[model samples]
Target: MDKFTTLTGVAAPMPLVNIDTDMIIPKQFLKTIKRSGLGKNLFDELRYEADGTEKPEFVLNQPAYRNAEIIIAGDNFGCGSSREHAPWALLDFGVRCVISTSFADIFYNNCFKNGILPIALPQDVVDTLMEDAGRGSNARLTIDLEGMKVVTSDGTEFPFELDPFRRHCLLNGLDDIGLTMEKADSIRGFEEQMATARPWI
Candidate 1:
């Protein structure tokens, strides 16, 4: 997972509320354990027509938002089934951060595990950011983890809160496996001691 320090990119506006996990990647695309290659299928149902053509009306399908790396989404985003693939798909699609007024708790934590920042701001602030996002690709937003704030293109800033442990994890690129790996020396010592104490067993 990439370390999330400071990210500056175009923010796509998605004001549709209650965007569930199924909407994020759809259940049909959940067969693969691998994280790569899901970007094309992300928002599959919304992004494509029945004939597999791109839907021009979709925010991501629009010319200016085609490469959006940040999303200012509606309330209760990521609110359904606890599919880890939702974050995987978002990450694959280059969306490193999602700002919403609120989020589902499970989905919120999953975002951190996969290196995507899920920001929850007041409705007023999110509304303002969504407007800024619609200002086109040049209105890039900057997320500064070290600074604990989101900066609009014009330098307007909104501070946010995150658990210290999660902040540490994102800053250091430490996933569950990475945290366990850091205890390798202690783990090895414990195994060695166990082996010596019970050779027959």
Candidate 2:
């Protein structure tokens, strides 16, 4: 996991609500447990046609948003199935943050575990950011996690709330495994003590 302190980059506007996990990476691409190679297929159905050609009308297909590092989406973002691949696909596609009015519980947690920040802001605030993101590549949004605020290109700032523990984990680049590793010394000490006490066994 990568430490997420502050991120400044292009933000693509996706106003569609109820964006389920399947729509993110599609079920066909879920055969592999690996997180890499899924970026190319992120939003596959929306990005391509039946012939597998690029869809020009899609927001991600646009030149300006092709390399967007953040996504400002509609309400109920990351709804439906609880597949962890959704966040993996998003992170692999260079999307380090996602801002929306609301998000599904499972997907929101998964985002943090995968080093992607999923922010839930009020609808009005999201609308403003969405408009800001419409400025193509010219506008770049900055998210300061330590400061707990999102700054627009024009200097407007919106504060968001996040769990303190999650913030700590992201700041230190600690995943579940990383958290466990933090207690390695204590674990080893405990094991040694147990061996001495149970020598006969």
Candidate 3:
């Protein structure tokens, strides 16, 4: 996981609601436990044709959105199955933050763990950001996690709420394993004591 203090980059507008985990990476691509290389398969059904060619009509295939780092999406984003691959693909594709009116609970939690910032704002706020994202390459959005603000290219700022604990983890690049590693000394000590107390086992 990478630290996510601040990010300023292209924002792609995805207004479709109920973008499930399967849509993000598709079921066929879920066989691998590895997180890398999934970006190419991200939105496989929508981004690629049945012949495995790029879909020109897809938002991600558009030249302006090809390198989009932020996503302004519709309500109920990340709905459906709880597969963690969705966030992995998005992160690999360079999306550091996602701004939506709402998100599914499991997916929202997974984003934090995977170093992706999933922001929930009011519908009006999302609408404004979505419009800004539509301005093409000239319009860039800034997401400052420490400041909890998303600033549009035109200088409009919108504040969003995030759990303090999740914010701390992302700022420090700490995933579940990272969090455990933070208490390495204590864990080691506990193991030693257990070994000595139960030598027969």
Model 3 TM-score on a 0 to 1 scale: 0.96
- Each prediction's whole-model lDDT (CA): 0.96, 0.96, 0.93
Worst 10 residues of 3 by lDDT: 154-163
Give the count of colliding residue pairs in each prediction. 0, 0, 0
Alpha-carbon RMSD, each predicted model: 0.8, 0.8, 1.1
Q: What tens-digit string does per-residue lDDT give for candidate 2 at 34-131?
A: 98989999999999999999999999999999999999999999999999999999999999999999999999999989999999999999999999
Model 2 TM-score (2 dp): 0.98
* Candidate 3: tens digits of C-alpha lDDT, residues 1-201: 889999999999999988888999899999999989999999899999899999999999999999999999999999999999999999999899989999999999999999999999999999989888999879999999999999999898898888899999999999999999999999999999999999887
Q: Which 10-residue window in model 2 sums to the lowest lDDT?
A: 192-201
The whole-model C-alpha lDDT of candidate 1 against the native structure comes to: 0.96
Residues 34-124 of candidate 1 have per-residue lDDT tens digits of 9999999999999999999999999999999999999999999999999999999999999999999999999999999999999999999
TM-score of 1: 0.98
Q: Tell me the TM-score of each prediction against the true structure.
A: 0.98, 0.98, 0.96
